[model samples]
Target: MWALRRAYNPLKRRGFCIGTSRACGAKSELGSCHLDEKASVGEAAQVIADRSLSLKRFYSTTGDSSKFFMGRRSFSSQAGAKSSGEVDDDLEDGFSELESPASAEAILESNAEDENEDELISEPEPSEGDDEDAAVEEPQNELELSDTETDVTEKRSPRKGVPSALFKAIVAAPGLSVHNVLDKWVEEGNDLTRAEISLAMLNLRKRRMYGRALQLSEWLESTKRLDFVERDYASRLDLIAKIRGLHTAEKYIEKIPKSLRGEVIYRTLLANCVSINNVKKAEEVFNKMKDLEFSITPFACNQLLLLYKRFDKKKIADVLLLMEKENVKPSLFTYRILIDTKGQSNDITGMDQIVETMKAEGIEPDINTQAVLAKHYVAGGLKEKAEAVLKEMEGGNLNGNRWACQALLPLYAGLGKADEVGRVWKVCESNPRFDECMAAIEAWGKLNKIEAAEAVFDRMLKTAKKLSSKHYSALLKVYINHKMLVKGKDLVKRMADSGCKIGPLTWDALVKLYVEAGELEKADSILQKAVQQSQMRPMFCSYMVIMDQYTNRGDIHNSEKMFHRMRQAGYMSRLRPFQSLIQAYINAKAPAYGIRERMKADNVFPNKALAGQLAQVDAFRRTAVSDLLD
Candidate 1:
């Protein structure tokens, strides 16, 4: 699955068509930037919102979402600055408490038609809000580092091969607590090695079963059966942040032995803060690391890049300056972020120049970087440049990198290269990966080959016997694209019936399916259901889909609600949501009263495109007599 920054939007994601949706239950591939409605949304943009590095966060009711870094900026004024006909409610109350990230969550939980019918599947579509950088992003930094014990964790097979007895007992046990299970396993004199525990942790985290993972960590810590290394502490901190709130993780830091409270633990917390887009807290944590006189890692700096890439691009230069001061050589991910920023800005020359600089430093462009280049080149309408980059990705050796197929499929599809898509598919035809299959479905769907896409889905279902909702989402996307509402519904029904875990990606597909089918009410209902699930955050596209539909209908009231809900859901699309809100008011032949003030309250200034929309909205307003006298 893909983990794009921002939106990597279908219609608007700048380049690298992959979005956070790709990071669903499947492995999140790095190729796209986290991008947004306008620009600057990446894997971190939503969950690439992680760099979907490509950082990705998956929401799960089974446990806390794997990633989240979201909080509102402290505007000069917000709560005291309302220009309203109606008063604020608990939703705005959440936004008002800027200091505590915990108080900022304002999800409205409502029971859907099938609330308890079946368990939901893997983390659904990349929320595009989760900071998607799953690969070069945090998971690499957060979990598997070459120096850490978790390196062995990554080597263990993903889903195949024999699972350890500890794993079986943990899974077989009911509820998140597997103490009895662990006790029984130990009672039978089954030995527990750190490697075995590491493998079990890998399996649990992979399945997004963070609660059980936490329990496992707690058991390890409480039992003290094995020696605790810095990595063990770091891993536990990450799981704490992942399962508990960031604040809880912050508190856990004090519990760490002072000597063991090294750079890794603090950076882990910082990464979590950045993951949520909690700018103030991220800054505080980053500053704290400096106060402690710790050597800053590129991982830490990249965390800032991930944060600013979404919420504040202006601050990115500052982070770069610090990296320079600290002599932190830019990693491939650093260059990728820089390149993506330039690409998002449409500065093709700058992007290329960054690559040139990266090469000059002897850091060759990796597969993900090449993918980013192709994406931007296509976005810039430089077809040949894009193709040249794609050729570079293919290189002389097809077997050099198995993962390159994930990048290839989408870049080709973005170029509308149907033949190339199929050719790439042939190479992986012998044993396609989950992510590769996802890319093929997307590529085929983009090329309008619904049947081919469906065939891939069918094959995936048969091969991957217990496919997640993410798998279903691929086909659902195909159906939505072709406007086959009945088929889309049938697929969704089958997913639920099969007891696949419903998630953000699934919700996004459902919302799009209904919206495209002209059922705004149903679409709205589905979004509400997603909002109700505390662990999940809806994709920016999902909210935009319904909001835009309301704007089309000139239903300003519902549009405003969706807009508010979106902000509450941790999405801050700088333009699209506002444009929809204003357009709704304009279309309804009503004055967008105090719209400017509202934008100011959120620290959003109108650009040329927005100014034009505002101009139309302002034209209908009654001029004040006092202003005329003045």
Candidate 2:
């Protein structure tokens, strides 16, 4: 029983009760080394009884207790091993009685059974010091026993193995990507192995958690686990997405595998940057490409040239000089971008340089570029210099966009050069896009050449496009300026018939014309209709029109009533209407009008002011006829 107890303890620690005590001793160290201090006493006792019974039965039946290692540790040896097999049966019965989750009782019961079943069954041929060996084993077993047992297995079983616990926690991460989990664990100082982390990262990447994969890859790089190939590809992808300028793009060119740094990649990235207005980044990429001995596209060079000229012409010139020194060939488009930007910035100095560069390149500056340059010249009041560019464009094979004609037409119109205007108009007529004809018409009107202006208007109608309010307004104002009332009314009617929105200016013009021509009824009808149409009228203009209509018709009472209404509506001041009231009073000459006459006249048309002085002079002249009458 004691021997059985010795073998059973190790078996309980290993989670298996396989054989007799001595037989179990061969694998005892492998099993016992893993046991902790928290194993359960009941489990330990059960293990003890089971191992002891198995050991005793096998040893007694085989008559070889050497393999079992029981020796004197059990009562079979101490009481008498009269028959080893019979003693084994007794030990088995003892084990069944003591194996009720208690080790000590099972040992004692096995001892009593051995003593009771002392009859010999089978005799073993002793080839060794069997009695002494048994005695030594018993004392050792007794010394190893403790007074109190602990259920260490119960307390420690939950946390038994490190590998199993770690795996459980990792797998139970609620479908979390393994790469993310590894990164979190590493970040948290969880001591997860690198191989484990790498495996997790790979798993996550395979699941298409690309963002998470990139994070882990970055972490791997930060941690210095990143290999050459991954680092190269990742850097290239990132650079293509973010870096813009030629200088920056050039810098990345070297990092790219030799096979990938072709014109397509280079030009594509450069063009994208230019379009998106990322010029600085594009410049950096371009510079980087230079170090790699790669050639840039003409378009890229042109875009860069334009960017430089637009933002800082002087700086760009310096860059161009530097590039020239480096033997970089500038394309014609490069000169064109230069011309365009210089013209846009009104940089005359840059424009001269652009012309010089175009000459050096043996390339004719396109008409659009030349037109912009000419327009700048015109703005500076240098018309002759602008004409020179236009003249040069005529002789050269300039691609004729509407730009030059548009610029030149206005310039000629401003100078009142009708011949030049006609010439520009002809060019404008050739191209459908140019609005030069409209501009020429406006200029003629501005110069007070209403006849020529009307001629231009008739030409615009031939274009078959609907007449715009702007065109109508221009012509309307021209007619009004000439006091051509009939023509002005016709223009307004034409504007309305064409569904053109009449503005306040147009309405004011028409109203003033009618009132000036003494067409009071016509002016009044127009005003009422305008007001009903909800057309916003200038308050002063409306009041003036109404007053003009009443005054022209000699309707003093109606005029006075309108005056009061205007004042009440906050549109007219009492002071403004005082003169008209005084005039009306003087004209009527009714009862009590004599004493109030001079006073009323002075109040509105004071002799100290223009209206007053005029009224006082008229009064003096009229009264002068009645000299000495009083």
Candidate 3:
């Protein structure tokens, strides 16, 4: 019996139990068993008794012994017994004798079984449809997670209202090749929305990737998938001209279907022509719009008016009459243009009439209108009226407006109203931008108030967080005008020490100062060094400076050298350089005729002014040679 007990303990630890009496088909008579079956029956009874003792111990450890007995019948029934009725009665009888606690190991085993059974009872099985859905969604969820991770890793999140994916794809495409990437996106079942396309265009434009922007616009237009409105077509045309030049834009307009070339498209093209100063193309488009009886907009007329106002002030009236004939109402811009034209021509009465007409038309004068009125009045010597206009601007919420204050200061300076200039400076001094300070400095410089200019400059230096080359240049100009060479030179040195990049304008100002002070050699040397170190290409102003100084000194050798340098530095097509060189050649009695041939070779035909100047120089040379021989 002791050996059987030892063997039974190991089997119980291993979760092996003896078969039930039901399995042997012998219920209700365990004590009356035959001797041959006695050993097996006794073992079975001992195993059942041990399991019951384990359950009681488990329940005592968990503090639920009564609940354990209550659940015992159900647990036994669920274990797939051979006979439910016999198994229930036997389990109840065994639990009834389980008052004594069992071993810790047996209790733990019974508790584990109870938890597993509870789990089986609590959890429901998933259906086949649910399994299929999970399988389908698994890859999709993984793909989304990977995309999110990639976005985080690449740091290509959306910015400025542009989508992350769209912006990243556009940036990844090579120069002007965004259309190819966009096509790939379409192939991948992703389509760009119109808003996205517009935003991409705007982003590319801001980045100055005009070629790629134009390509994208062209691609979008060619697809015919988008319902492009007038503004879209106009923006596209404007970009086309900006990227591919005006001629290409004209050709593109010609290629557009006649039916689609409505007034809006023609107006856009006309505006482009005006912007590029293609007067012929502008006129052609304007005539076409008129011939088609398309209502010409005031903006288009304003452009034409601006173009004509440059050379023919009389033609401005004709454009106005044309606008009146076409029943095209003049916008505020049109009135401003007319006011500017009349002011330039000294037609003060006409300007006043236009102002009254605008007022009659219920068009209030904006800040721009006030600025134009003041500028023209100043130009026409109406200082009192200009001051009134400026005062009106101040009353109209332009008080402390830096730009308005800047503009007014210069006008007051021009009018010799130093007190008014000081008052305007006070108004802007509270929070002066660099431009405003520079403008104030310039105003004081214009008034020849060197001390006032220096004071403003000093204040700017002390208050400004960041100073650009222009600010330095403005102060340098004041020093130059006053012939303060030592101060100007010291400022230049300080600019260099401070690592401020010397712009062309600053270099020009310094060179002009030196040249004006008769330090020709130093001026030339400084200009040469600046040209070498400057990241910008040498401008015509630099070459013109040296050429003018050398020619005036009759140093024809150096003058010609400077001319060749200008050409080598790619400043062709400027008539002033050629004129300077020709004058220097003629003055030196060298071969002056070769300049004309060179101009022809460069495809720059001498204008009437240049030709007449050349002829006069030739005749003067002849007179000088004759006087020398006599």
Per-model TM against the reference = 0.72, 0.29, 0.51
Per-residue C-alpha lDDT of model 2 across residues 125-166, encoded as one tens digit per residue: 111111211111111111100011222232234432222323
After superposition, which runs of candidate 1 have C-alpha atoms over 4 Å from their true positions? Answer: 1-142, 145-162, 529-541, 564-583, 586-630
TM-score pick, better of 1 and 3: 1
Per-residue accuracy of model 1 over 515-573 as CA lDDT, tens digit each: 88888999999889777864666666677778888888999889999989988876562
lDDT of 2 at 115: 12
**Residue 250 alpha-carbon offset, candidate 2, angstroms:** 16
Model 1: number of clashes? 90
lDDT of each: 0.61, 0.43, 0.54
lDDT of 3 at 197: 66
Q: What is the lDDT of residue 295 in candidate 3?
A: 64
What lDDT does candidate 1 reach at residue 47? 25
Error of 2 at 555 (Å): 51
Pairing residues by index, what is the TM-score of model 3? 0.51
In model 2, the runs with Cα more than 4 Å from the true position are 1-261, 284-293, 336-350, 396-407, 411-419, 427-630
